[model samples]
Target chain A: MERKVCAHIQCRLGPMRLGWHGTIQTVADVIKMLFKEVYAPSGADKLMFYLAPLIVLIAPFIVCALIPFGRNLVVADVSMGIPLIIAVNGFGVLGILLGGWSSNNKYSLLGALRSGAQMISYEISFTMILLFVVMISGSTNLMSITLGQEGTILDWWIFKIPVLGIVAFILFFISSTAEMNRAPFDIAEAEQELTGGYHTEYNGTPFAMFYLAEYIALVTNSALATTCFLGGFLPPCIGVAFVDNYLNMVPGVVWFFAKVYFMIWCYMMVRWTFVRPRVDQLMDFEWKFLLPVNLVLLATGAAYIVIWG
Target chain B: MSEYIILSIFLFLGAFIAAAATVTGLLLGYRTKNTANKMAPYECGMETIGNARIQFKVGYYLFALLFLVFDIEALFLFPVMMNFREIMAGHTPLSPMIVLIDLAIFIVILVSGLAYAWKKGILKWE
Candidate 1:
């Protein structure tokens, strides 16, 4: 009788059966594949190989902890928040380099080397753009920077500095996209050329670690951009009295997540829209174009702050 | 500090989550006996060739070196940037003009190095 009832229910819910049962089976298969030893590292330096995924897994979360979700809702409100973020993110490159080198595959090695070069190169412009924000806001703390633009949308850094603000935001956006190794700047993991790049040999749960790290990094980068450029957690106060009051009633965290998600959506669009550039062209774009332009913008931003203040 | 404690806790949580996933995969997944071909580094289904760690061009190394010099320079400029408002407010020892000139000079030197690299064709991709 129980078997007959089970068969009847299964037949009745046939379309819905795949939804839950299929998902569980897929999860089980993935778990089995993850545990199967595909390529075991056997050498004196085997310990370092294991450290790679662990670092990649945890570093982004550490960076995420420093980001302020709301006015006073940060996990760690360090004084040197921006610099701390830049410094901790540098460890992500270490994991990629180690994973690639230890994989004992040619494609992985090439991908790892490219990743190192790409990240270090873009990080210069990335930091320079942050410096412009620091100079304008006059504080290394992200909370103060966000608070500096609290009153109105016009007060935000993107609008506050006129042309320089917009230019800096664009430059920061580009460099950060490259820094995160998304789409156009993802020569490190170019599928046609370098296979899977640094994590080519990775599989199972270890591969998932790198994959999760990349998404987490993407979220952190977009959130930082939102906090630094857009007014962090500030609602659009259009100066209309009732509308402003209504918008303000929504919690700051909601506003923060809304803006961050919008930025993430923009990033996803860019990733899907553009084709990856050649490695040399990628380097050329940074050195010949971005670096020089950013330098000029940095000086201009400094002058703007000094002359206007 | 309490802030550092929070950061450490967050870090620990991230690690714990990652470890749990990996351990669960290991414990629940079926283990198959390793074979020579199955364990080899993948090369598009071809037999493994010579080691992948062969020497490439030195141009990449040169670019990284240039990046290092400028990155350090940017770090040194952070203090000047952070203090711009204070200098302008007349709270600092240095005047705005003096600070601006100091920054201009530092930038000029860095720019000249970049120019040198360009002139030497080190920045050239082809």
Candidate 2:
């Protein structure tokens, strides 16, 4: 009885202590510890070490600005949306390369080199899939693509083009995973091999930046996928009167995020479920399997467009 | 114009967030002088060894070269893709058959090159 009373008092006091001052103090302590880890004097080049993480963190945010969350709700509706996204994302590879090289560590350098090669190989298929989408959608603007699929579930690119659409969606999904440096394609930072890959020497806020960049890229890629293939912000309605009427009541923005998070959930599942592929297997898989399939898919998309139109 | 302005603002905001995090860490974190051993490259807790940087296989460079070729070829298809609707609508002088045949030829050449690389064992990692 006495122990139970003491426990009750302790739980109540714990909540009171954690309300305000406790929270602030904890945050301050964390900041101090983070700074200590980050500011430790190291032999690596200071400029590249710092700059690379910053660039990687920021690049994804900038790329995401061009993505349309809802109609006219985009931060920037650029004409060259697809190309711009590709260009900005390409900068992320440079940042990784620089971070690895500047660390003056062998493991970091190898990790960086692997990242460069992996990104370049996957980018070929990535671009081809985007081109295929552009061919079918008839515009490079993301907004237009979203609008094109505004009708119903059947109008979405993933279903509209039959076999080619599904193939492109799968190809895009895989390549985007590679582009974001997520597993099983994440050979660059395979911990068993490269000891944290490009960010081996990173700690503190610099490491935080790399972490931030990755999650942001995941969210942005999901949004890109939602926009390109899954009928961005379009609720499911198969030309039914009641369902269409009911679904349209919910805001497009909500639909947009719901779909985006669902895709993000899928990515999380994929990351956890798969083991990392060997580096040679990764290259061969891309060069032999993904590359050829994407080439054929692109051609099929083009032929379909010409023959049908 | 406004769109570019928004994009610039977004970029600036990202940079600002990154700088703030780093600065906060720098200001709050403790600083210590580096010792020779402390500054040395990490090697799984072993003593100093030879340089970590060594020549890698030529296969990586070869893949990079091939990537450049294929990527550029893919880019060339962009204009044709974007204008596909126009060609189909009979708005342009180009015929659908010519466009289809042209893309087919380009893809055929690209695939053949891939075949050559695969046959040469350049794609093999081992």
Task: List candidate 1 segments past 4 Å from native.
Answer: A1-45
Lowest lDDT 10-mer window, candidate 1 chain A? A1-10
Clashing pairs in 2: A35-B29
lDDT tens per residue, model 1, A1-309: 122223344554222333453435445545565775433433213555566788777788988998888988888888888777777777788888898888878888889889988998899899999989998998888888899998778888888889888999899889999998888799999999989999888777777778878888988998999899999888878778888999999999999999988888777767766778898899889999999999889877776766788
Interface RMSD values for all candidates:
2.4, 2.2
Tens digits of per-residue lDDT, candidate 2, A34-110, equal 66646422557788777887788768988789888887688888877887787788788888988888887888889
Position A191, candidate 1: lDDT: 95
lDDT of each: 0.81, 0.82
DockQ value of candidate 1: 0.58
Q: Report the C-alpha displacement of residue A133, candidate 2, in angstroms.
A: 0.6
Q: Highest DockQ: which candidate?
A: 2
